[model samples]
Target: MIARRPEGADMEAKLFGSRLSPFVEKVARALQLKGIAFTLVPPKSPADFKRWNAQTRKMPVVEIDGRRVFDSTLILRRLDQLVPEPPLLDRDAGIAARQRFLEDWSDESLYWYAMALRWSDANAEATTTQVLGSIPAPAALRPVLRVVLRRQLRNQALAQGLARLPLETVVDELGRRFDELLVWLGDRPYFFADRPSVADLALFGQLNVLQSGPTPQAERLVAERPRLADYFLRVDAATAERRAEPGRGAARGVDFGTTARGA
Candidate 1:
Protein backbone atom coordinates (compact mmCIF):
# COMPACT_ATOMS: atom_id res chain seq x y z
CA MET A 1 0.00 0.00 0.00
CA ILE A 2 1.21 3.48 -0.75
CA ALA A 3 1.86 5.86 2.13
CA ARG A 4 -1.53 7.31 2.96
CA ARG A 5 -1.89 10.98 2.13
CA PRO A 6 -4.78 13.30 2.92
CA GLU A 7 -6.64 14.70 -0.08
CA GLY A 8 -9.58 16.95 -0.88
CA ALA A 9 -8.51 19.59 1.59
CA ASP A 10 -10.66 21.99 -0.34
CA MET A 11 -13.62 19.67 -0.67
CA GLU A 12 -16.85 21.27 0.53
CA ALA A 13 -18.29 18.38 2.46
CA LYS A 14 -20.91 18.87 5.17
CA LEU A 15 -22.00 16.06 7.52
CA PHE A 16 -25.48 16.25 9.03
CA GLY A 17 -26.33 14.52 12.33
CA SER A 18 -25.65 14.38 16.00
CA ARG A 19 -22.13 13.21 16.72
CA LEU A 20 -23.53 11.17 19.59
CA SER A 21 -25.12 8.80 17.11
CA PRO A 22 -22.84 5.88 16.20
CA PHE A 23 -23.87 6.15 12.57
CA VAL A 24 -22.78 9.77 12.51
CA GLU A 25 -19.49 8.95 14.17
CA LYS A 26 -18.83 6.23 11.63
CA VAL A 27 -18.98 8.67 8.76
CA ALA A 28 -17.14 11.42 10.66
CA ARG A 29 -14.21 9.15 11.44
CA ALA A 30 -14.09 8.04 7.83
CA LEU A 31 -13.87 11.64 6.68
CA GLN A 32 -11.08 12.49 9.10
CA LEU A 33 -9.08 9.40 8.15
CA LYS A 34 -9.54 10.13 4.46
CA GLY A 35 -7.94 13.53 5.03
CA ILE A 36 -11.03 15.30 3.91
CA ALA A 37 -11.88 18.49 5.74
CA PHE A 38 -15.59 18.92 6.15
CA THR A 39 -18.06 20.79 8.33
CA LEU A 40 -20.31 18.94 10.73
CA VAL A 41 -23.86 20.25 10.39
CA PRO A 42 -25.46 19.46 13.72
CA PRO A 43 -29.23 19.45 13.77
CA LYS A 44 -30.78 22.74 14.78
CA SER A 45 -34.01 20.99 15.64
CA PRO A 46 -35.71 17.65 15.13
CA ALA A 47 -36.86 19.12 11.84
CA ASP A 48 -33.33 18.99 10.37
CA PHE A 49 -33.53 15.22 10.33
CA LYS A 50 -36.19 15.06 7.62
CA ARG A 51 -34.87 18.20 5.99
CA TRP A 52 -31.43 16.72 5.47
CA ASN A 53 -32.60 13.20 4.65
CA ALA A 54 -36.21 13.10 3.63
CA GLN A 55 -35.95 9.50 2.49
CA THR A 56 -35.02 7.96 5.87
CA ARG A 57 -34.71 10.94 8.24
CA LYS A 58 -31.78 9.15 9.88
CA MET A 59 -28.45 10.82 9.76
CA PRO A 60 -24.79 11.05 9.20
CA VAL A 61 -25.79 12.50 5.87
CA VAL A 62 -23.00 13.81 3.67
CA GLU A 63 -23.48 16.66 1.20
CA ILE A 64 -20.70 16.86 -1.32
CA ASP A 65 -20.66 19.79 -3.71
CA GLY A 66 -24.48 19.68 -3.59
CA ARG A 67 -25.44 16.04 -3.73
CA ARG A 68 -26.70 14.72 -0.38
CA VAL A 69 -26.00 11.16 0.65
CA PHE A 70 -27.25 9.24 3.67
CA ASP A 71 -26.32 6.04 5.46
CA SER A 72 -22.84 5.46 6.85
CA THR A 73 -21.80 2.77 4.36
CA LEU A 74 -22.61 4.93 1.35
CA ILE A 75 -20.84 7.91 2.92
CA LEU A 76 -17.66 5.89 3.35
CA ARG A 77 -17.89 4.75 -0.25
CA ARG A 78 -18.19 8.36 -1.27
CA LEU A 79 -15.08 9.17 0.76
CA ASP A 80 -13.11 6.45 -1.03
CA GLN A 81 -14.21 7.87 -4.37
CA LEU A 82 -13.19 11.39 -3.36
CA VAL A 83 -9.84 10.34 -1.92
CA PRO A 84 -8.59 6.98 -3.16
CA GLU A 85 -5.33 7.00 -1.24
CA PRO A 86 -5.12 4.38 1.50
CA PRO A 87 -8.28 2.70 0.42
CA LEU A 88 -10.95 1.93 3.05
CA LEU A 89 -11.63 -1.32 1.17
CA ASP A 90 -8.77 -3.63 0.35
CA ARG A 91 -7.51 -4.35 -3.18
CA ASP A 92 -7.63 -8.12 -2.69
CA ALA A 93 -11.08 -9.37 -3.53
CA GLY A 94 -11.23 -11.88 -0.70
CA ILE A 95 -10.00 -9.43 1.90
CA ALA A 96 -12.28 -6.71 0.64
CA ALA A 97 -15.18 -9.10 0.81
CA ARG A 98 -14.33 -10.01 4.39
CA GLN A 99 -14.00 -6.35 5.27
CA ARG A 100 -17.34 -5.58 3.68
CA PHE A 101 -19.08 -8.34 5.64
CA LEU A 102 -17.51 -7.17 8.85
CA GLU A 103 -18.56 -3.62 8.04
CA ASP A 104 -22.15 -4.71 7.55
CA TRP A 105 -22.11 -6.84 10.67
CA SER A 106 -20.86 -3.93 12.66
CA ASP A 107 -23.47 -1.62 11.22
CA GLU A 108 -26.49 -3.91 10.97
CA SER A 109 -25.87 -6.33 13.83
CA LEU A 110 -23.65 -4.84 16.50
CA TYR A 111 -25.35 -1.48 16.08
CA TRP A 112 -28.70 -2.79 17.26
CA TYR A 113 -27.07 -4.47 20.22
CA ALA A 114 -25.50 -1.17 21.19
CA MET A 115 -28.77 0.63 20.60
CA ALA A 116 -30.77 -1.88 22.58
CA LEU A 117 -28.42 -1.38 25.47
CA ARG A 118 -28.51 2.37 25.14
CA TRP A 119 -32.30 2.52 25.10
CA SER A 120 -32.62 -0.18 27.70
CA ASP A 121 -34.39 0.73 30.93
CA ALA A 122 -31.14 0.99 32.85
CA ASN A 123 -29.53 3.49 30.51
CA ALA A 124 -32.47 5.38 29.05
CA GLU A 125 -32.25 8.48 31.17
CA ALA A 126 -28.57 8.98 30.56
CA THR A 127 -28.92 8.31 26.87
CA THR A 128 -31.83 10.71 26.61
CA THR A 129 -29.97 13.49 28.36
CA GLN A 130 -26.82 13.01 26.32
CA VAL A 131 -28.75 13.06 23.06
CA LEU A 132 -30.96 15.98 24.07
CA GLY A 133 -27.95 17.95 25.18
CA SER A 134 -26.89 18.23 21.55
CA ILE A 135 -30.25 18.97 19.97
CA PRO A 136 -30.39 22.71 20.80
CA ALA A 137 -34.02 22.63 21.76
CA PRO A 138 -35.61 25.11 24.08
CA ALA A 139 -35.36 24.39 27.79
CA ALA A 140 -39.08 23.79 28.32
CA LEU A 141 -39.27 21.41 25.35
CA ARG A 142 -36.45 19.19 26.62
CA PRO A 143 -38.68 17.11 28.84
CA VAL A 144 -41.17 16.57 26.07
CA LEU A 145 -38.44 15.72 23.56
CA ARG A 146 -36.87 13.44 26.10
CA VAL A 147 -40.01 11.37 26.45
CA VAL A 148 -40.70 11.29 22.73
CA LEU A 149 -37.14 10.47 21.74
CA ARG A 150 -36.78 7.76 24.35
CA ARG A 151 -40.06 6.13 23.45
CA GLN A 152 -39.35 6.29 19.74
CA LEU A 153 -35.85 4.82 20.00
CA ARG A 154 -36.89 2.16 22.47
CA ASN A 155 -39.70 1.17 20.16
CA GLN A 156 -37.28 0.85 17.28
CA ALA A 157 -34.94 -1.24 19.39
CA LEU A 158 -37.85 -3.45 20.39
CA ALA A 159 -38.93 -3.81 16.80
CA GLN A 160 -35.38 -4.91 15.96
CA GLY A 161 -35.81 -7.80 18.48
CA LEU A 162 -32.92 -7.11 20.84
CA ALA A 163 -34.37 -4.59 23.30
CA ARG A 164 -37.11 -7.00 24.37
CA LEU A 165 -34.53 -9.25 25.98
CA PRO A 166 -33.31 -8.51 29.48
CA LEU A 167 -30.45 -6.03 29.73
CA GLU A 168 -28.18 -8.76 31.07
CA THR A 169 -28.86 -10.89 28.01
CA VAL A 170 -28.11 -7.98 25.71
CA VAL A 171 -24.86 -7.32 27.52
CA ASP A 172 -23.87 -10.97 27.36
CA GLU A 173 -24.64 -11.29 23.67
CA LEU A 174 -22.73 -8.10 22.95
CA GLY A 175 -19.75 -9.56 24.74
CA ARG A 176 -19.84 -12.64 22.58
CA ARG A 177 -19.94 -10.48 19.49
CA PHE A 178 -16.93 -8.58 20.79
CA ASP A 179 -15.14 -11.88 21.27
CA GLU A 180 -15.83 -12.84 17.66
CA LEU A 181 -14.64 -9.43 16.60
CA LEU A 182 -11.34 -10.05 18.33
CA VAL A 183 -11.10 -13.40 16.59
CA TRP A 184 -11.63 -11.77 13.20
CA LEU A 185 -9.27 -9.00 14.23
CA GLY A 186 -6.59 -11.55 15.28
CA ASP A 187 -3.30 -9.77 15.86
CA ARG A 188 -3.85 -7.04 13.30
CA PRO A 189 -3.60 -3.43 14.47
CA TYR A 190 -6.85 -2.76 12.68
CA PHE A 191 -9.59 -5.17 11.70
CA PHE A 192 -8.25 -7.33 8.85
CA ALA A 193 -5.66 -4.77 7.86
CA ASP A 194 -2.53 -2.97 8.99
CA ARG A 195 -4.46 0.23 8.24
CA PRO A 196 -7.96 1.32 9.13
CA SER A 197 -10.88 0.35 6.89
CA VAL A 198 -14.66 0.61 6.87
CA ALA A 199 -14.79 -2.46 9.09
CA ASP A 200 -12.62 -0.84 11.73
CA LEU A 201 -14.53 2.43 11.46
CA ALA A 202 -17.86 0.66 11.81
CA LEU A 203 -16.76 -1.34 14.83
CA PHE A 204 -15.22 1.76 16.31
CA GLY A 205 -18.47 3.65 15.88
CA GLN A 206 -20.50 1.10 17.82
CA LEU A 207 -17.87 0.72 20.51
CA ASN A 208 -17.51 4.47 20.69
CA VAL A 209 -21.21 4.93 21.50
CA LEU A 210 -21.39 1.98 23.86
CA GLN A 211 -18.72 3.60 25.97
CA SER A 212 -19.48 7.18 25.16
CA GLY A 213 -20.82 8.01 28.69
CA PRO A 214 -24.38 6.62 28.56
CA THR A 215 -24.05 2.85 28.76
CA PRO A 216 -22.00 1.80 31.74
CA GLN A 217 -23.08 -1.81 31.42
CA ALA A 218 -21.87 -1.87 27.85
CA GLU A 219 -18.76 0.08 28.78
CA ARG A 220 -17.93 -2.55 31.37
CA LEU A 221 -18.31 -5.14 28.67
CA VAL A 222 -15.54 -3.45 26.71
CA ALA A 223 -13.51 -2.89 29.89
CA GLU A 224 -13.12 -6.64 30.33
CA ARG A 225 -11.41 -7.07 26.98
CA PRO A 226 -8.08 -5.25 26.96
CA ARG A 227 -7.41 -6.16 23.35
CA LEU A 228 -10.72 -4.81 22.11
CA ALA A 229 -10.28 -1.64 24.13
CA ASP A 230 -6.79 -1.14 22.74
CA TYR A 231 -7.99 -1.76 19.25
CA PHE A 232 -10.49 1.06 19.69
CA LEU A 233 -7.69 3.42 20.67
CA ARG A 234 -5.46 2.44 17.75
CA VAL A 235 -8.26 3.06 15.28
CA ASP A 236 -8.90 6.41 16.94
CA ALA A 237 -5.27 7.42 16.65
CA ALA A 238 -5.29 6.53 12.97
CA THR A 239 -8.43 8.41 12.01
CA ALA A 240 -9.41 10.97 14.64
CA GLU A 241 -6.40 13.27 14.63
CA ARG A 242 -6.83 15.97 12.03
CA ARG A 243 -10.54 16.34 12.72
CA ALA A 244 -9.90 16.32 16.44
CA GLU A 245 -11.39 19.80 16.51
CA PRO A 246 -13.37 19.32 19.73
CA GLY A 247 -16.60 21.25 19.03
CA ARG A 248 -15.91 21.67 15.37
CA GLY A 249 -16.04 19.12 12.56
CA ALA A 250 -14.47 16.38 14.68
CA ALA A 251 -16.68 14.18 16.78
CA ARG A 252 -15.24 13.36 20.17
CA GLY A 253 -13.61 9.91 20.44
CA VAL A 254 -13.03 7.85 23.55
CA ASP A 255 -9.34 7.74 24.30
CA PHE A 256 -9.02 4.51 26.27
CA GLY A 257 -5.42 5.51 26.67
CA THR A 258 -6.65 8.09 29.17
CA THR A 259 -10.16 7.01 30.20
CA ALA A 260 -10.71 3.36 31.04
CA ARG A 261 -14.01 1.88 30.03
CA GLY A 262 -15.40 1.75 33.53
CA ALA A 263 -13.75 4.95 34.60
Candidate 2:
Protein backbone atom coordinates (compact mmCIF):
# COMPACT_ATOMS: atom_id res chain seq x y z
CA MET A 1 0.00 0.00 0.00
CA ILE A 2 1.20 3.52 -0.74
CA ALA A 3 1.97 5.57 2.38
CA ARG A 4 -0.26 8.44 3.27
CA ARG A 5 1.23 11.82 4.20
CA PRO A 6 1.17 12.81 7.87
CA GLU A 7 -1.28 15.58 8.68
CA GLY A 8 0.91 17.97 10.75
CA ALA A 9 4.26 17.36 9.05
CA ASP A 10 5.87 19.35 6.30
CA MET A 11 4.29 19.06 2.89
CA GLU A 12 5.86 16.49 0.62
CA ALA A 13 8.31 17.86 -1.96
CA LYS A 14 7.82 17.38 -5.70
CA LEU A 15 9.63 15.00 -8.06
CA PHE A 16 9.44 15.41 -11.84
CA GLY A 17 9.82 12.13 -13.71
CA SER A 18 8.32 9.40 -15.85
CA ARG A 19 7.11 5.92 -14.85
CA LEU A 20 9.29 4.15 -17.43
CA SER A 21 12.47 5.90 -16.27
CA PRO A 22 14.52 3.59 -14.07
CA PHE A 23 16.63 6.44 -12.73
CA VAL A 24 13.56 8.23 -11.45
CA GLU A 25 12.20 5.01 -9.94
CA LYS A 26 15.51 4.48 -8.13
CA VAL A 27 15.34 7.87 -6.43
CA ALA A 28 11.68 7.36 -5.58
CA ARG A 29 12.36 3.98 -4.06
CA ALA A 30 15.20 5.44 -1.99
CA LEU A 31 12.93 8.14 -0.65
CA GLN A 32 10.24 5.60 0.10
CA LEU A 33 12.69 3.32 1.87
CA LYS A 34 13.99 6.21 3.93
CA GLY A 35 10.42 7.17 4.89
CA ILE A 36 10.87 10.54 3.22
CA ALA A 37 7.79 12.33 1.92
CA PHE A 38 7.54 13.24 -1.76
CA THR A 39 5.06 14.06 -4.53
CA LEU A 40 5.59 12.71 -8.02
CA VAL A 41 5.03 14.61 -11.28
CA PRO A 42 5.46 13.12 -14.71
CA PRO A 43 7.60 14.94 -17.25
CA LYS A 44 5.63 16.47 -20.13
CA SER A 45 7.68 14.52 -22.66
CA PRO A 46 11.25 13.41 -23.38
CA ALA A 47 11.95 16.80 -24.96
CA ASP A 48 9.85 18.92 -22.64
CA PHE A 49 11.99 22.04 -22.33
CA LYS A 50 10.00 23.58 -19.48
CA ARG A 51 10.81 20.70 -17.16
CA TRP A 52 14.46 20.43 -18.30
CA ASN A 53 15.05 24.20 -18.29
CA ALA A 54 14.42 24.42 -14.56
CA GLN A 55 17.49 22.47 -13.46
CA THR A 56 19.91 20.03 -15.11
CA ARG A 57 17.82 19.59 -18.23
CA LYS A 58 16.80 16.17 -16.94
CA MET A 59 13.83 14.32 -15.62
CA PRO A 60 13.84 13.23 -11.93
CA VAL A 61 14.70 16.70 -10.68
CA VAL A 62 13.88 16.71 -6.94
CA GLU A 63 12.66 19.80 -5.12
CA ILE A 64 13.35 19.73 -1.39
CA ASP A 65 13.30 22.53 1.17
CA GLY A 66 12.87 24.93 -1.75
CA ARG A 67 16.10 23.70 -3.35
CA ARG A 68 16.20 21.63 -6.51
CA VAL A 69 18.62 18.75 -7.06
CA PHE A 70 19.26 17.06 -10.43
CA ASP A 71 20.91 13.75 -11.29
CA SER A 72 20.15 10.44 -9.55
CA THR A 73 23.62 9.99 -7.99
CA LEU A 74 23.64 13.46 -6.44
CA ILE A 75 20.11 12.98 -5.16
CA LEU A 76 21.07 9.71 -3.49
CA ARG A 77 24.12 11.36 -1.93
CA ARG A 78 21.98 14.16 -0.57
CA LEU A 79 19.54 11.65 0.94
CA ASP A 80 22.44 9.89 2.69
CA GLN A 81 23.32 13.12 4.46
CA LEU A 82 19.75 13.62 5.61
CA VAL A 83 19.52 10.12 7.09
CA PRO A 84 22.99 8.76 7.75
CA GLU A 85 21.69 5.69 9.52
CA PRO A 86 21.02 2.62 7.38
CA PRO A 87 23.97 3.89 5.35
CA LEU A 88 24.21 3.43 1.59
CA LEU A 89 28.02 3.47 1.40
CA ASP A 90 30.47 1.22 3.16
CA ARG A 91 32.93 2.53 5.76
CA ASP A 92 35.73 0.63 4.07
CA ALA A 93 37.33 2.74 1.38
CA GLY A 94 38.41 -0.07 -0.91
CA ILE A 95 35.04 -1.74 -0.89
CA ALA A 96 33.28 1.57 -1.34
CA ALA A 97 35.46 2.36 -4.34
CA ARG A 98 34.60 -0.95 -5.96
CA GLN A 99 30.92 -0.40 -5.26
CA ARG A 100 31.11 3.04 -6.83
CA PHE A 101 32.75 1.59 -9.92
CA LEU A 102 29.99 -0.97 -10.30
CA GLU A 103 27.39 1.69 -9.66
CA ASP A 104 28.81 3.82 -12.46
CA TRP A 105 28.98 0.85 -14.82
CA SER A 106 25.36 -0.09 -14.09
CA ASP A 107 24.19 3.46 -14.60
CA GLU A 108 25.98 4.01 -17.90
CA SER A 109 26.76 0.68 -19.52
CA LEU A 110 23.81 -1.45 -18.41
CA TYR A 111 21.36 1.39 -18.90
CA TRP A 112 22.44 1.84 -22.50
CA TYR A 113 22.08 -1.86 -23.15
CA ALA A 114 18.55 -1.76 -21.77
CA MET A 115 17.76 1.25 -23.93
CA ALA A 116 19.13 -0.49 -27.01
CA LEU A 117 16.93 -3.48 -26.35
CA ARG A 118 13.95 -1.23 -25.78
CA TRP A 119 14.38 0.67 -29.04
CA SER A 120 14.98 -2.40 -31.16
CA ASP A 121 12.17 -4.52 -29.76
CA ALA A 122 9.19 -5.53 -31.89
CA ASN A 123 6.90 -2.93 -30.27
CA ALA A 124 9.51 -0.21 -30.81
CA GLU A 125 7.73 1.72 -33.53
CA ALA A 126 4.37 1.73 -31.72
CA THR A 127 5.89 2.68 -28.35
CA THR A 128 7.90 5.45 -29.93
CA THR A 129 4.85 6.83 -31.67
CA GLN A 130 2.83 6.84 -28.44
CA VAL A 131 5.52 8.50 -26.32
CA LEU A 132 6.56 11.09 -28.91
CA GLY A 133 3.06 11.75 -30.15
CA SER A 134 2.04 13.22 -26.79
CA ILE A 135 4.17 16.24 -27.56
CA PRO A 136 2.08 18.96 -29.19
CA ALA A 137 3.38 19.08 -32.74
CA PRO A 138 1.74 20.54 -35.83
CA ALA A 139 -0.50 18.18 -37.83
CA ALA A 140 1.43 18.98 -41.02
CA LEU A 141 4.70 18.14 -39.19
CA ARG A 142 3.80 14.61 -37.95
CA PRO A 143 5.90 12.96 -40.66
CA VAL A 144 8.82 15.15 -39.66
CA LEU A 145 8.37 13.99 -36.06
CA ARG A 146 8.63 10.35 -37.10
CA VAL A 147 11.86 11.12 -38.99
CA VAL A 148 13.26 12.96 -35.97
CA LEU A 149 12.45 10.05 -33.62
CA ARG A 150 14.16 7.49 -35.86
CA ARG A 151 17.24 9.68 -36.05
CA GLN A 152 17.19 10.12 -32.28
CA LEU A 153 17.10 6.36 -31.74
CA ARG A 154 20.03 5.95 -34.12
CA ASN A 155 21.93 8.69 -32.32
CA GLN A 156 21.26 7.05 -28.96
CA ALA A 157 22.64 3.76 -30.27
CA LEU A 158 25.72 5.55 -31.62
CA ALA A 159 26.30 7.38 -28.34
CA GLN A 160 26.20 4.09 -26.42
CA GLY A 161 28.79 2.43 -28.75
CA LEU A 162 26.22 -0.24 -29.67
CA ALA A 163 25.38 1.06 -33.15
CA ARG A 164 28.22 -0.87 -34.76
CA LEU A 165 27.74 -4.02 -32.68
CA PRO A 166 25.43 -6.64 -34.15
CA LEU A 167 22.15 -7.28 -32.30
CA GLU A 168 23.36 -10.75 -31.30
CA THR A 169 26.58 -9.29 -29.97
CA VAL A 170 24.68 -6.79 -27.86
CA VAL A 171 22.49 -9.54 -26.40
CA ASP A 172 25.50 -11.72 -25.69
CA GLU A 173 27.42 -8.95 -23.90
CA LEU A 174 24.44 -8.02 -21.77
CA GLY A 175 23.90 -11.66 -20.80
CA ARG A 176 27.60 -12.04 -19.95
CA ARG A 177 27.50 -8.98 -17.69
CA PHE A 178 24.41 -10.23 -15.89
CA ASP A 179 26.05 -13.58 -15.27
CA GLU A 180 29.19 -11.93 -13.93
CA LEU A 181 27.21 -9.65 -11.61
CA LEU A 182 25.19 -12.53 -10.18
CA VAL A 183 28.30 -14.57 -9.50
CA TRP A 184 29.96 -11.58 -7.89
CA LEU A 185 26.96 -11.01 -5.66
CA GLY A 186 26.91 -14.70 -4.65
CA ASP A 187 24.58 -15.46 -1.73
CA ARG A 188 24.74 -12.02 -0.18
CA PRO A 189 21.45 -10.36 0.77
CA TYR A 190 22.68 -7.18 -0.83
CA PHE A 191 24.99 -6.45 -3.76
CA PHE A 192 27.91 -4.80 -1.90
CA ALA A 193 27.21 -5.04 1.79
CA ASP A 194 24.98 -6.57 4.45
CA ARG A 195 22.31 -4.10 3.43
CA PRO A 196 21.30 -2.19 0.30
CA SER A 197 23.89 0.30 -0.95
CA VAL A 198 24.16 2.80 -3.79
CA ALA A 199 25.42 0.04 -6.04
CA ASP A 200 22.34 -2.04 -5.36
CA LEU A 201 20.13 0.92 -6.12
CA ALA A 202 21.83 1.43 -9.45
CA LEU A 203 21.73 -2.24 -10.32
CA PHE A 204 18.14 -2.67 -9.23
CA GLY A 205 17.05 0.33 -11.28
CA GLN A 206 18.58 -0.98 -14.50
CA LEU A 207 17.46 -4.51 -13.81
CA ASN A 208 13.89 -3.39 -13.21
CA VAL A 209 13.89 -1.90 -16.70
CA LEU A 210 15.11 -5.11 -18.25
CA GLN A 211 12.59 -7.26 -16.43
CA SER A 212 9.66 -5.01 -17.27
CA GLY A 213 10.61 -4.53 -20.91
CA PRO A 214 10.28 -6.95 -23.82
CA THR A 215 13.77 -8.42 -23.58
CA PRO A 216 14.11 -12.21 -23.42
CA GLN A 217 17.68 -12.13 -22.12
CA ALA A 218 16.65 -9.78 -19.35
CA GLU A 219 13.95 -12.21 -18.28
CA ARG A 220 16.41 -15.08 -18.35
CA LEU A 221 18.91 -13.16 -16.23
CA VAL A 222 16.29 -12.52 -13.56
CA ALA A 223 15.29 -16.15 -13.50
CA GLU A 224 18.93 -17.18 -13.07
CA ARG A 225 19.42 -14.78 -10.14
CA PRO A 226 16.58 -15.74 -7.86
CA ARG A 227 18.36 -14.33 -4.80
CA LEU A 228 18.86 -10.98 -6.48
CA ALA A 229 15.18 -10.99 -7.41
CA ASP A 230 14.37 -11.65 -3.76
CA TYR A 231 16.53 -8.71 -2.74
CA PHE A 232 14.45 -6.41 -4.94
CA LEU A 233 11.28 -7.84 -3.46
CA ARG A 234 12.59 -7.15 0.04
CA VAL A 235 13.41 -3.57 -0.85
CA ASP A 236 9.93 -3.08 -2.20
CA ALA A 237 8.41 -4.63 0.91
CA ALA A 238 10.44 -2.36 3.17
CA THR A 239 9.21 0.66 1.28
CA ALA A 240 5.65 -0.51 1.61
CA GLU A 241 6.02 -1.06 5.34
CA ARG A 242 7.48 2.38 5.90
CA ARG A 243 4.62 3.89 3.98
CA ALA A 244 2.03 1.91 5.92
CA GLU A 245 2.88 3.14 9.39
CA PRO A 246 0.57 5.87 10.68
CA GLY A 247 1.86 9.24 11.99
CA ARG A 248 5.52 8.42 11.47
CA GLY A 249 6.29 11.86 10.21
CA ALA A 250 9.59 12.53 11.96
CA ALA A 251 11.62 11.25 9.07
CA ARG A 252 8.85 11.06 6.55
CA GLY A 253 8.08 14.76 6.15
CA VAL A 254 11.50 16.31 6.71
CA ASP A 255 13.42 18.11 3.95
CA PHE A 256 16.81 17.21 2.43
CA GLY A 257 18.05 20.30 4.36
CA THR A 258 21.29 22.32 4.03
CA THR A 259 23.52 19.36 3.26
CA ALA A 260 21.63 18.94 0.01
CA ARG A 261 22.74 22.43 -1.00
CA GLY A 262 26.40 21.42 -0.59
CA ALA A 263 26.69 24.09 2.09
- Which candidate wins on TM-score? 1
In candidate 2, which residue pairs clash? Answer: none
Model 1, range 1-263, lDDT digits (tens) per residue? 86433565556578787767778878877877766676677887888889888898899799886688999999899889877876899888888999999999989999899888889888899888878877879899888998899988889999999889998988888888889888988998987778888998888888888888888987788789999889988887787646443433433333223222332
- In model 1, the clashing pairs are none
Shift in Å, residue 105, candidate 2? 1.0
Q: Across residues 19-122, which tens digit of lDDT does each residue of candidate 2 receive?
A: 35667767766776555667666654456635554555766777776677888888888777766655678888887887778888888788888777666645
The regions of model 2 sitting more than 4 angstroms off are 1-11, 47-50, 53-56, 121-123, 126-147, 239-241, 248-263
lDDT of predicted model 2: 0.65
Compute each candidate's TM-score over C-alphas.
0.90, 0.78
Per candidate, the number of residue pairs that clash is 0, 0
Error (Å) of candidate 2 at residue 143 is: 7.6
Question: Could you give the C-alpha RMSD of every candidate to the true structure, in order shown?
Answer: 4.2, 7.2
